[model samples]
Target: ADGYDSGGSDEREFADAWLMRAHGHNAVDLDEIDAAEDALQETQFLLDDFAGLIDDFESQGGSARDLFEIVRQVVNNKKTEAGETN
Candidate 1:
């Protein structure tokens, strides 16, 4: 592409940083790499749904904070179901 660095080093660095932050380390086995890829894919799927919901809600004049509160409540309810406190 006809972009910034021309060598794409910047894009590689950004991807490396993102992957490191997501998986916590660069030294991992093949299985771990597979697991991380699976987890990331699943998270992307969830984020697509979450983003859609946020867009729909905002389109209706709803506050993003309200969506966050709903997520918090869901987390708390799950914890309660699992006998977790606080």
Candidate 2:
């Protein structure tokens, strides 16, 4: 979903709805907003790391590339799973 072959669609939709409702009521919760922003920032950093790992793998041609991708996918999948439960 969300342009990625990976998961997390349900989590994304729920969060978006929560934010919209909070904004509509003019009662935004700073803690929740901060937590969401933090999660996004953390995920972005993980993605940046993945990009760097890919570049390094391309240049070095090592065996770890597959392992790295697998790890990334697993982490992302977990995030999607957690999001769905919320």
Any residue pairs clashing in model 1, and if so which?
A: none
lDDT of each residue in 1-86, candidate 2, tens digit only:
46744257897788779898878687768999999999999999999998888788777876675867888888889989888532
- How many clashes does each candidate structure show, in the order listed? 0, 0
The candidate that wins on TM-score is: 1
Residue 5 miss distance in model 2 (angstroms): 58
Per-candidate TM vs. native? 0.47, 0.43
Off by over 4 Å in 1: 1-29, 77-83
Q: Local distance difference test, per candidate? A: 0.89, 0.82
- Please report how far candidate 2 places residue 65 from its true position, in Å: 9.9
lDDT of 1 by residue, 1-86 (tens): 55544358897898878888988664558998899999999999999999998999999999999889998999999999999999
